[model samples]
Target: MRSRLALPIALIAAVSVAATACQSSSGKSSSDAAAKDAPKAASSVADYNPQPYDNIKDGGTYTTAGTFDDQGNPFNVNATLTASRVWSWYNADAITYSPTGEVQYNPDYYSDVKVSVEGGHQKVVLTINPKAVFNDGTPIDWTAIEATWKANNGSDKAYSASTTAGYDGITSVEKGVDAKQAVITFKGVDASWSSLFTTFLHPKAATVDNFNQAYVKKAHPEWGAGPYTVGSWDEHSGNITFVRNPKWWGKKGKLDKRVYVNLESAAAVNAFKNGQLDYTSAVDAESLKQIKGLAGTEIRSGGSPFEYSLNFNTKSPILSEKAVRQAIQESVDRPQIAKIQFQGLDYKEPLPGSAVLHSFQKGYQDNVSAVLKYAPDEARKTLDAAGWKPGSDGVRVKDGKKLEVGYTLLGDDALGKATAGALTAMLKQIGVRLVIKKADDADFSKILSERNFDLFLSGNRSMDPFAARYLCDFYCSDHDSNITGSGTPELNKEITATTEIADLDAQNAAVNEVEQKALQEYAFLPLFSGPSTYGVKKGLANVGATIFYSPLPETIGWQK
Candidate 1:
């Protein structure tokens, strides 16, 4: 999320790298994506400078950085935000959504939409624009749409689709009246029928062999069908370059070139200061001070979809015990962590309550507050009841084992280190020993994949506004993007049924109920949903910290 990761349609949204460690798309797919008509979060909740195409200059290169390439997979659940953002640049988009939840058909691809429910099964009809074509001159038609659905609908284990969320409900995808139209039929009444196909996969990539192997070492520009195409992918430099696509049928992309350079925190901030980067993250106070008021910079900020939190690994011997995990979670001071995190920034949010929805969003509930409160005495009692008694070193012991867990401290950021110190002190209050391990910021993705740490500070970012559907990713199991060992098969099965409830309010209530049950496990301790703040090289437009506004590839450029 913060560095490089695929942000899914829902984001697969990675918590911005600006948080503690690299956080990524914790939101994948769920049947209940809250509701389209639900109250929207205020625009003030986000602060991206809103500049339309008319306001942007026509020809300037815009550069940013991240860990990208996506292993060549178009929709890997673990894809980084940079990859998804880049994918948007080179792919045909069928839908356009606002920072709030309003949706519209982008006329570049889709011409009409018709909905119906026949014999209790929901069916949708979509017409692709006759003029639309892929970069290779293939007509953008129903076959491309069908290919995306079949690859992801869980029918074929062979295809490496991200998640089977909305796609799994589809019973069939057939050609409508002509090659330009698609007819989609779902198994039953589906609440989130419109949530699928915001973007498309070129039919060629959907083939079993190509779907799995096509994008590994190189990005196939000919398979892309958007404003920009992959120009270069330098493995040695970990840099990717994109140039305006000559084959694009839509309006020309404003920038002549786009690039994502992989850099760690210190170098990235330095790059921003040196004017090498058009956009840089400044989530912590130390980083914020660097670019806050440089002559050419403007601090663009808004409510982040990312939630920074302390995640507990249930597989660790010291943490596997539910009581120990519960007590450790209860003892931490979230507000204190917040105080340390936002020390200099003019940002404050209610301690994050749910992994599903941010506090500013409608249908959000303070689920964590009631379950894990700041109570040291009670946490001590919890340990006492579980046969953990204070010993000679004042650390709790259970059956001759010390009640200690290792925490991976990522990077040299002062705020990150300071919060670790606060965490150590809080654990001491309950007679638990917290061992700290130091690692370079670049080691974040490596450490997470190998499950190297017992305790970690990470964020779960969301890309779409209707996050209720992502509960399956957050709590169902640690199969895909979810790294915290916090799910059970029984709970996952229950969550699937709960998300499919047709009534909006009832489904949200059900989603919350399921999440509360999951949080009771104490795997992920929700800290706070911090601001997605960035330092922008002044004059940059249509890009900054906003929730659901994925820029129309051509619109992100220097202001005129």
Candidate 2:
């Protein structure tokens, strides 16, 4: 039998709640001194050893820094990155993909998963564990499966999902031979089937209204099924606490409590210096510098599956012409931008070539070098050939219109601001005026949702190793997340072809073809591919920086 642990789902909305209320009070001052005096340790970003359960010590509290406000609702389409991080602990998935792209199943939740294809249709059978149940005593069976499918399958307009790539292909979900088994049938062969079910909602809360509005400021811990329960939430301080669940049926988790504190990029580093944050990502140059000399801290760096890119709003008048978009793509110097962003850091990323596959992933091919080359001379020539002529002020003019574009700075992060400044200077050399429009983090989503920018710096993190999952989500014409508006019938057909191939090699080849075509059209400009860096408190094992692997909460504790 697989070990089971209970996890929390909601925040108890009280601003005055003390962090000590959830765990034994060590008193903040003494704990801070001890944290500063602890022995230092280090790990690499490529390392994926989750410490053996036997080596982990029991009964301790861990605190970490997060970027965004909690959404509470993981199923919501607009859920923040921090919410996703928190969900990894509180929610259970049938299967999960590792940082190195290994797929493993959670035996505590499902006994087995079988995949088969017949008559051009793919089917998946999931066998839920008999003893598994939500905190409210609801069986983790067909109702949950059906609700998950209905909410994410894209058949209904009411249900809002982050991405409908895999779920949209599902035709039906029916009960299998037993009450604990679920039989899912797809409309056609989908090689990305494993990507679905990373998150699920209860049947009662799967409705449109409940999924969106019900969890706005509330956390319904009753819907959670992990090893911890919602202890307290101090909204004013942006601290959330999770305590051990007495009803957990599996091996007792090592940590007595877990706390996630919301802090901005720079503030998070200061918190770590003050012995408040146990783990925090060192994303910018300044954060990396501040943590270098910190005692009892370890800096882990590696190549990340995430990449930043300049997304073009093809519908905008300034970027409507294909030649103009191609020119803008060729003008920007990705290497220089990478150098500036990661100046003092140990890791530096190479110019990214593919939008679908990162350089570290298998089957990655350099498709952008031929089309999106960084050559300002070539960019000027392309613009001149496309009826855009240099004006007296050195800005391009085409048929009484100026070749000016607006670049939206989503967050006031140092890396983004530096990139924008560099890009503004580079574009001017090619007779294109780039305007930097600053947008608050809170308003960034609204701007993207309304498609109100000509160009923006954005990125996508692969949920799975398979590149097919990203094809439709990022490039499909009708996808809600397709802000570029650059999809075509041929591109759509090529993307669909990748999903139909079951073999990994064949699917990768098909994806490369799609990427080449997309890059030729200048769909989106790929920047650098690098890993997320973090400063972790030494002795805290399996709780720091990671790429693909979501650390199991039960396995995270002080090293014995």
Candidate 3:
């Protein structure tokens, strides 16, 4: 049975609340610091103006930092795409984001069905729309939908390890009256299953043979259901450009051409400022400030569901101990990190509350903030109480072993490295030895998957809460979910049930209980929750550009 812990605020990462934290200087009160450094408000909203097509070129390229390589190699059709690029080509079980952080998906535009919580589970029912069609001109129907699942996750023996792994409770996908209606049965009514309604439907004919040979390798095989098709590829440059689908199933092309270029941070910014690129998204605070003087450039501030955090490797004996974990958690100075490390650009409180785990609602900020903050003295006492003795080097030693914690830092971001250094320095003062290692993204992921590090910085961007399902699998004992080989069976069972709960309230309740228990046990440390900043070029109209920062549709194109 799932443990019933206290109801915490539902921050996407933990507890639930819709409070906002103002960015301020490190070590000062948030209110006092924000007052001094805040930027002046814009005088007035600019009038809308649309740019004419004749004035704009049909094909213009843009370069951005951060590689879409994590989206999975397009060369490997058998690979499961994990980034936003995958979601752009294929739909999900459901869409969880909107232009304004709403929880509902626009079914009319994205799907023919409207889903809601019923009987403690999300029932899959459809609303008939005669207009929806596939790129091949095939009328959108239940057969195509069912076939897509079978080819990916069902027993057709074609593909395995799909996005539908989260929807393990799905019993069958069957056709209903005529071809338009479909019935999806589950083992139980699940409110969480509402997340599975926006899946990308594939053509039965294309995937019936072999996905790799027939679909992926072939030049743009007819698979995706979006408004664009895979366009040109530059092997040497490491880029994939997309073109407007002349036969799009949804709204016709709003932007002329969308190109995704993978380059280093400095080069990308240089390209943007020199007019070599029209628009670029996902610019951090420092990059935003660098190009503030560029003509026609405007920086748009927004919040993302992405949570940046520090993971404590349960495999290490010292970290494997509960008291040491708590001591580390207690020592983090969030206010200082927000001001000095993150430059007052990120959300001030890291684990303020839990509502973030459920929805990116506006009112859910502070419920969790009150609980998580720096208590350095408490952290020191906790370490001492745990029988750790300070040695000549000022590092803690217990049972003849030194408390040497390793943290892997990606060399790309300066702020990230600075934050890591600050954390290492702070920990050292408390008799804890922190060793920081530098690695690229791919190597870090490999090390993390192999459970080779004592600690590291990692994050996830997803509106759906299922990503949290992997938490228990990361450290639960004797369980394949135990990626760290340090999981305890009792804690594993507590989190397992949180993922499978059918009732929204009950599931949330269960998750809260597990988090409290995990916090008590110091299972994983939570850091700051913040936004992915972007600089929007003036006069360029786009609706959901940040939605696809890692690469997919480059920008929701509109002329100003």
Candidate 4:
């Protein structure tokens, strides 16, 4: 499950939130003192214009720019964030999020959600709203929940699951008082039990082939139940149009149609300028300038729950050695990249220290600095010690192999392209060859599932406030979402055990300790935090960045 994670309307890496005391391997915050000296954009939450439901007009068409990838299926283990975002629009959400990151059951899908401790096991009773029905008229019931659990609980390896963390903890998902209620029982106590069952898969999709292979290039809108359903999808242009579901039982959607077009950063901005798109990314200097003096559009800026990181494919030959990965991270100057990234935007932040928590968030600490730092000279020495010798071409060579790494970049954003170019030069200084591959927005899911690059630069955007949930996502080798391939059986056991802790703080601390060990493997390097900037038409409401809150389509439309 994505747990509702994705980059919408042109990807932009942003910030995080949590109350954590994650320490470095040395058991201390290595950069807390340095953090005290800098200004931070995360001091404020996202400023997406919020208006009451009554304030939105009854009907309109809201078209926005977004990436479209052939992600196989929304529930496929190899599914990309793009696929998840598109799937979300046409599916019923079991839960809804407030702008401040609070989770509440969506009454449209559930009549009641009861959590309790029965026989020392955390149990959840979800009462499905009887009025809820899929587009195909399949009644929403325990069968669907059971099917989702069976496919994602890692019980059958043939069925590819994104992560078996929350699902693995469940002992059984049986019918409750009736078919409308699902009685979910966990093996042990889990404080974050509410995080699971956020979305359900169709009971008919329980087969391995259907879960993993059969749905590529298919939205399968018939299996979905929500306010909107896919009206049309253009395979050539990678564009999709959604219309109100004729069989929807909930309140009517505010807009008559929602259109998502695959547009690169430059093209998205141009489209927005020409009134073709309702939303466009402007987080970087160059993109922001394109809309500087636009009369009808405004830039919305504030904290976001997206975080940027470079995931090292440790299974690859060159990066198989932890030392090489560490050296590469040390050679890259993050501050230089940040300065270039936020140059003209004036978005200030202390050097980011944690991939899961931003500086302005509660319990935020510097976990990255103690493990790695920008020291090109030291990095060179480390590479030399690791048996990578400088060849006549100036690139490092070991065992007749050059220390070359492939980096996959998506879209044609000027700032993203420039950043990749800067990274190429930075790695060259350390005698490592950085080969760049620029791909279109539509190829993102393909590149990720194929592992086509040694280094994948992307953001882990969150839909919930629980950062501890990602421990398994990033540290369990069997978890398909752990793209780094650095997880071990030992780490997986530790993370799974940590999730069972009854206290939130104890669970967080235990997860942090295990995280410290996993990160030392050097397969993941933390980079930028936030200041999510988006150019939006003035009257659009309940859309754009709202920190971690994702509003339903029924609540987003043109302001009256």
Give lDDT per model, in order: 0.71, 0.69, 0.50, 0.74
TM-score per model over all chains: 0.87, 0.89, 0.74, 0.90
Winning candidate number (lDDT): 4
**Per-prediction RMSD in angstroms?**
6.5, 10.3, 7.4, 4.1
Winning model by TM-score: 4
Better of 1 and 2 by lDDT: 1
Least well predicted 10-residue stretch by lDDT in candidate 4: 14-23
lDDT of 1 by residue, 497-527 (tens): 7656777667777777788888998898877
Candidate 1, overall lDDT?
Answer: 0.71
Give the lDDT of residue 521 in candidate 3. 50
Comparing 1 with 3 on lDDT, the higher-scoring candidate is 1
Q: 135, model 4: CA deviation in Å? A: 1.6
The digit string of per-residue lDDT tens for model 3 on 1-560 reads 00011111111111110112343223445454553443322101121222333333344433333223432322222222223343354332224434343345544333456455555554475643456565567776776656655554434444422333334556777776666776776665555554454444456542644433443323332545555666766655656666777665444445556666665555666777787665444334565566666778865544445444566777676688878877886776554554544453433333324423522432232323334445667788988999988899899888898888887776556666667778888788788888877776455435644667777665444444443344443334643223345556787777666666655556666666555555455545445545444455665544222321221232345443
Query: Any runs in candidate 2 off by more than 4 Å, and if so which?
Result: 1-45, 67-72
User: lDDT for model 2, on a 0 to 1 scale?
Assistant: 0.69
Against the correct fold, how does model 1 do in TM-score? 0.87
